[model samples]
Target: MEIRRLAGRVRTAIARADQKLVTFVQSHANLTTALVTAGLALWALSTHQSAIVLRMAAAGAVGYFLGLTPAVCVGALSVGFSVAISLEHGFSISNLIIEVIGAGCSAWLGYQHKMQKVRQEQAADPHAPQVLPWAVVNEIRTSLAAIRFLLFPLHDEEGSRENQALQQATQELSRLEALFREMEQRDRAGEGR
Candidate 1:
């Protein structure tokens, strides 16, 4: 009983810690990434070790995890740190050039990896809400409205039952389209919040 109680307490603590971490990450991802980058750079400088491959991999991973802009920033910071360290010792132009190229390339590679992952996820998630471009949505709506307008002329050219049915179907299409638009807007607003 005591062991179970202890285990429960541990689980609760772990859950709380995880929740806190999630909140911190979501709220201050950029700040956390920058802080971590600085810390890693400082560690490398202090160790007096040129961890080039490690730096490259880290930059790429950060890019993948954070995004393209942050990845680029990571590469920039890495280059900055490398320059500072080289200035302290005998400056090696060749090493600096390699580092510059490596950092830039790694960042781009990571961003590409991230984009691929996004595509894969979207492909896998069949039910995922697809957010179309606003302009495209507007264009489609305009086309539908124009079609409806053409179907519903001011002068009734054909008062046949088939014509009335077509008009009703178009009205139903318009209602459904408006509902879809309203739902999409709500979803977008919710995402922003």
Candidate 2:
């Protein structure tokens, strides 16, 4: 009986800790999004170039939702912004095909990297539930995956942090799951008797 009570207390403690971490992640994500939106809005107002403004705004919006790799979004936006500036200054593209190819290649690379990160995170936390309504596990996985994309193909600072948080989340989730399962089993067994 004491052992069971101790296990219950431990599970409760882990659940509370996980909830706090999840809250922190959510708060940080909201802050990041707000900052991106405000920055893009300000940039849009200051830029005389309408095309550049739109590109920045779109990229910033994507970055905000991605919650990771704001740099990649910024880099992509810069490329398009530079092209726009060049066009405005009378740089003509001789081959539209080449420009399209370049844009497509960059987008493909970004997408592929994002998918690979998702796979890695999934592999790392295989037992974790994929679709829990109350748990922010999927969001955590997504954020971590995107961070992995931003950090690779090298050591990822944000990815490491995300991984740690994800592991904690999974451990907490497992504890809760086990606790509930045990309770359900006990109740069913008593009913049968």
Candidate 3:
């Protein structure tokens, strides 16, 4: 009974720790990525593991491109440096090829991961506008162009009726843009909460 109780307590502690860890990672994703990359690079270098170094570099490049984490650059650079060191010992074309292939695959996977995350966010908040739909943006642009063309003759006049009308149209467009921006900000704030 004592052993069982002790095991139960241990399991509870582990569960709490895991929850905390998840929260920490979510809150400090960038820092976590950087630290993990550094640790991996250090391990690979210390072990003289060329494959590990190459894979890390590739993964880093992918993450960097996807804007997933800035630390990916550090990982890629560290791996490159490690590979150079290995080259000093013995130059192997096979190792270089592996590095290239690993980097390519990692980048592809990172891009896919980024797209998936974006899709998930959109699904979670259907009302939140991730981007202005192309058609709407194009319509706005067309309206602005028409307004400009119509008001071209009044460009030099400051107090004329045509000039005032032009200013009003421009202001209206600005207000619309501001409204979209405000909605996006509110959506982001809601997500944070």
Candidate 4:
């Protein structure tokens, strides 16, 4: 019990610290980006690290933190400085490729972040499409399917009033299922974007 309590306290402390860090980053985005970029520059220049992955990650991080403009600026700066350093030694085709790839990563990640923010804003609007929880929607669909089966035991009749009503009910259910399917597809497409 004592150990569990201590662990709980530690978890709470860690959570609080994480929240504080996120708050600071959000509130001081420019400062955070500048600081991170400066660190990246120092690390890259001092070590003369030509690791394309490192460049890409640094640029992407800065891009994800801000919007396209800052990301593009960071990408350009990083690529230009790295290329200059490479040129000082001799023109290396590999280094140029790495720099270009890093710049691309920066642009792509930044654009993604900006689009994500826009999506969040749209989701918050009442006019946006209603998105039900996927699992719950699936369960509802399953239940509807079971009810449909139960309603039409053997065969669907066209003439009898009772069967006609059941047929109409089945048609409505089918339409509802199609609607949910469409919604699911839309949700997936949105995520892929």
Pick by lDDT: which candidate is best? 1
Per-prediction backbone clash count:
0, 0, 2, 0
lDDT string for model 3 (1-193, tens) is 9999999999999999999999998777645545555665565577677566666665655574645354355445655775788777987666555454444445444655677678899899887336767876887787777667656764455567776777867876786688678867987797899
Give the per-residue lDDT digits (tens) of candidate 2, residues 16-126: 999999999876754554454455445445654444445444444443455336535554656666667678677645322333333333333444446657899999998
Q: Give the TM-score of candidate 1.
A: 0.46
Clashing pairs in 3: 58-103, 62-107
Candidates ranked by lDDT, best first?
1, 4, 3, 2
RMSD to native for every prediction? 12.9, 27.4, 15.9, 12.2
Candidate 4 global TM-score: 0.36
Over 4 Å off in model 3, which ranges? 1-79, 129-193
TM-score to true structure, per model: 0.46, 0.26, 0.34, 0.36
- Scored by Cα lDDT, where does model 4 land? 0.69
**Residue-wise C-alpha lDDT for candidate 4, range 58-159, written one tens digit per residue:** 667776777667777877877787777768778777656656654665566566766878889988894755768888678678767766665765665556
Q: How does model 3 score by TM-score?
A: 0.34
Error of 1 at 37 (Å): 20
Report, for every candidate in turn, its global Cα lDDT versus the true structure: 0.73, 0.55, 0.65, 0.69
